[model samples]
Target: MARAGSVAPRQRASAAPESGQRPGRRLLPRSRILLVLALVAALGAAGFGAWALYGSQWLRIEKVSVAWESGSRRELTADQVLSEAAVPLGAPMASLDKDAIEDRLLAALPRLKSVRVVRAWPHGVGLKVTEREPSAQVPAPGGFAEVDEEGVRFAEIAEPLPSVPLLEPDMADAPSVRRFDEERTLREAVAVAAALPEPLAERTSVIRIASYDAITLELSDDRTVRWGSPEDSSAKAGALTILMKAAPDARHFDVSVPSAPAASGG
Candidate 1:
């Protein structure tokens, strides 16, 4: 011990980094936790944006294309009819009502026999229409009513075709003309026309369905074809061809029974 001012040699301080770093070790875990939270938040935000853009009602029918079958291939543009039909643009594709649209279209175009509606994904609707085909014309009280293959009376025409056959009563005791049976008589008439020989068919101008069992055909040459039933029509037609060739000058020929060879008038 010296006098009042005494100085002990200072011990050499340790210069190597501290063997253990508590603050840095603690900070590493806290930084990792913050990084994980940030990543999770970013992923959640991305998912939400995707849902709003792709899964919303912004991707709906923007146009329609109407197509017709038979005759002219007229296509009605979407822009012309969509507004009048009241179809909402950008509406959900799942909410589209096809039946309602079909009804509206049919009402607008009465000439259409049937209509089909389809959805072309994303921005379009498709409509396919079938129009009525006029097969025959019959005289009505006011005018001539047009009939289809089904014999359904549709519309009236102002003018009459002179070449068409005039349906008349066969005998004085014949029953009055009844309502045309659309399904049976009309369909049978179409079948008969289709089955007639080209030469005989073109010459035929009038078809009279007297009853379910009796069908009489009046040809352009003022001859008569007594067809008893719709059965064996093709065979009867073939027989007529053979008979007509044999007796060209004959005023009338009856080939009703194709199986039995018979002839009248030379």
Candidate 2:
């Protein structure tokens, strides 16, 4: 009955999928496996990093050393600072309390102006120190106490340094005590000493303070400068410089009034 010239239609192939495998099931399992491997690797790296930073001996402090600014007077020895620091040896460097160490050092050593705690990587701690320099000397029991520019009496020395001047603040009178207390008087005298010119400061011998307005400076070679109070100190210093240059032979110089400086009695 079929036409002899036309071929019969070809039949289509029908294949069933394998068991437990959907259209994208094979790709999903492979993606999940890669994600789990990545997560495990990240966790392992974090654990190792934590152990290396804190729990490992390689990052722990083994040796401690102290270093100070060069050309500064070494008022405190390395042993003194170390003893006060009391840094825990064999502790992890990353776990050290830098601020605590600095606080202890400053509290124990009054001569230290500043302290910088540094981790000298791998196995050491370094303490960098800046010491207070003596601006003047105040008479204290058993010896002289060195005062810095801020009027802080830091150290006691048997003999004062030659370049440093002596401060004798006698704020015992009722009027002076009422106007300015002993502490303020001391601070004012220190301020005056600090404001002096370098050349005059080196030549100065003593700073005597009876009242706030009665601050006097006794210089070498029988010279004297009548510096009033701490007020107008900058102006006073400038006036004194010019007066001294103008009257080199004069023995008495008064710069209490910077506008009208006086000089007499060579």
Best by TM-score: 2
Highest lDDT: give the candidate number: 2
Query: How does model 2 score by TM-score?
Result: 0.85
Model 2 CA RMSD to the hidden true structure, in angstroms: 6.2
Give the C-alpha miss distance for residue 145 in model 1, angstroms. 2.4
CA lDDT scores, all candidates in order: 0.65, 0.89
Itemize residue pairs with steric clashes in candidate 2.
Answer: none
Residue 117, model 2: Cα distance from true site in angstroms: 0.3
TM-score of every candidate: 0.56, 0.85
Error of 1 at 47 (Å): 11
lDDT of 2 by residue, 59-149 (tens): 9999999999787779689999899999999998889999999999999999999999999999999999999988788998968999988
